[model samples]
Target: MKAGTNLEKILESGKFAVTAEAGPPKGTSAAVIQRKAEMLRHCCDAVNITDNQTAIVRMSSLAGCVIARQAGVEPVMQMVVRDRNRLALQADILGAIALGVGNFLCLSGDHQKFGNHPQAKGVFDIDSIQLIQMMKQMRDEKKFLNGDEISGDVPMYIGAAANPFADPFEYRVKRLAKKVKAGVDFIQTQAVYDVPRFARYMKMACDMGLDKKVHVLAGVIPIRSLGMARYMRDYVSGVTVPDEIITRLEKAEKAKEEGVKIILDIIEQLKEIPGVHGIHIMAVGWEDIVQEMVEKAGLMPRPVL
Candidate 1:
C-alpha cells in the first residue's frame, strides 16, 4: 500500500474510498474548517488540504492537514511546484512527515497571474512528474533530490491530478502513465461532469495497464445552481460539462437537490466502469451538504480506522 494511514488502508483494501477537499482560509481562523471537517467525520476516508489554491495565499496545507487530523479527518496534503523550489518542497515534505502526515498530491499549480498577487514571481523548478519522482526518491531510496543521504524514515502514499478533458485529449492517458511510472500511487482527476469522456480516458489507461498499478478516484463537484453549471462549462479550463447536464439543472425546480442527484448518478455509473476506484468529492463552499451527498450516493459510514 506504500502507506501507514487509514486512507492508504482503505484504498489498499479495494474499498470504494471517499475523499473530499476544502480550501484553507486566508486568515488564521480555524473554526470554519474545523466545523466543516467535523461534518465529514464518519463519511470520508480522507480530506485533501489544498496548498495556496488558485495561487492565492492562504493557510499552509501542512498546517491545515494537522487541523484536519485533530478534527478526526485524515488529510492528503497537496504540494504545488509553482510556489516552491526543490529545497523548500523537500523540507516541507520532511516537516509534514514529522507532523504525522502521510499522503500527498503533487501538482503544477495555476500560474501566478491568476492569483491576487500577480506581481509575485512564480517558481517552477520542477513539474508535477518530477515532483512525484523526487518524493519517491526520498521515500524509497532514502536520499534527497541532490543524492544526499537521509537517516530517518520518509514514506508517502503519493497522488497526482489528471485532466481527462484537457486539450490534445489523446495525450492525457500517456501523461498519466508517465506519472504512474514516476511513482504516483493514485490519481485524482479534474472536475468531471462528462463521465463518458472520463471513462474513455480510463479505457486507455486500463489498456495500458496503468489502472492495475494505481488507484484512480474520479473527481466531481456538485453544481449548486444553473449559474454554477454554466460557469463551469464556460469558464473552467480542462473541464467539460455537457449541455444536457446544464439543461437538466436549469429545468429542475430544486437545483441544489438536483445537483446532488447528478453527482449520485455519476458515482453509480463510475462504479460500473472498468478502471475507476472511487470518487473524490469537492463541493467547495457546500461542505455542509457532503453528508447528504455521500448518503444519497450510498457511500456513507466509512470503514472504522
Candidate 2:
C-alpha cells in the first residue's frame, strides 16, 4: 500500500472533508475500538482518536491510532497538551509518526477538574498554537526543541480546534486566524447548532481572506433527546441550541428519530455555506447513525488525497 495522507489531500483539493471521532474504551478491549473504526471506515476521510477527552482517562490515543492504522483506516492522532508537558507532547508525536500516523489534532485539553482525577495537577506547558508551531518546525526545519538538528523530519498534517459559538465570537475567529498563521493546516470547529451564526463567522473569515488559506470543518453533534438538548444548552460552553430545535425535540414522538432528522437538516443547511471545507460529526455514542446522516447529506466517500 502506498503511504498517503487523506486529510492533507482533502485540504489541498479545497473540498469539504469529513472526519469522525472514535472514543477509546476504558478497558483493554480492542473489539469496541475496532468495531467503531470499521463502521466509519467507508464514511469518514479520517478517524480522530481523542486523547483523554474530557480529561477522563481511557485507552491511550496513540494506541487507538495504531489500531486504526493496522485496520487499514487513516488515523488522526489527537494530542492534548494539558496532561503532558512539551517533552511528552514531542515524544508522543514522534512515536505516532513512527507508527505510520501522519495526521494530528492539537488541543489544550479539558481541565483536570472536569475529570475523575480532580486532584491531579494540570499542565498547560504549551498551548495548541505553540504546539502547531513546534510540529511545523519539527517537520519542515528538522529541528528539535533544544536547537539540535534532527536527521529526519516528522511528516505530519496538523489540525486545530475553534469554537465560534464561544463568548465574544469575534475573539474566536481572531484566535483561529492566529492558529492558521501559526501553520495549522486544518481546523475542526465546535458543534455549530446555529447555521446563521456560523455563516457570519465564515463571512468574517472570508473578509479577512483566511478562508482560502486553511480547511475548516464545521463540527456537528446530533441531539438525541429533549433532555440532551437541554443539557447542551445549559452546560456545554460554546454550544447553542435554537428554541425551534428544542420545541421540535419536545414535540417529536421519538427523540432519536427527531435528533437524526435535526442533524440531517443541519447538514443540508451547512452544505451550502461557502468556505465550509467539510463536516466533522461528533455523534458521541451514536456512531451507528453516522451512515444515515452522511447519506442524507449526500456526501460521498472521496479519498482525502
TM-score per prediction, in order, is: 0.98, 0.96
lDDT leader: 1
Each model's lDDT: 0.89, 0.86
> What TM-score does candidate 1 get on C-alpha atoms?
0.98
RMSD of each: 0.9, 1.9
Per-residue lDDT tens digits of candidate 2, residues 173-263? 8998999989888899999888899999998988888888888899999788899999999988779988989999989999889988988
Question: Mind giving the per-residue lDDT tens digits that candidate 1 earns over 1-305?
Answer: 46688878988888888899988899998876798788877778999999999899999999998898888888999999999999999999999998889999999998988889999989999999999999999999989999999889997999999999997999999999999999998899998889888889999999999888999999989888888988888887778999989888988999988888888898899888888888898888888788888898888778875
**In model 1, how large is the Cα lDDT of residue 117?**
90
TM-score, predicted candidate 2 vs. hidden true structure: 0.96
Off by over 4 Å in 1: none
Off by over 4 Å in 2: 1-4, 303-305
Best by TM-score: 1
lDDT agreement of model 1 with the native: 0.89
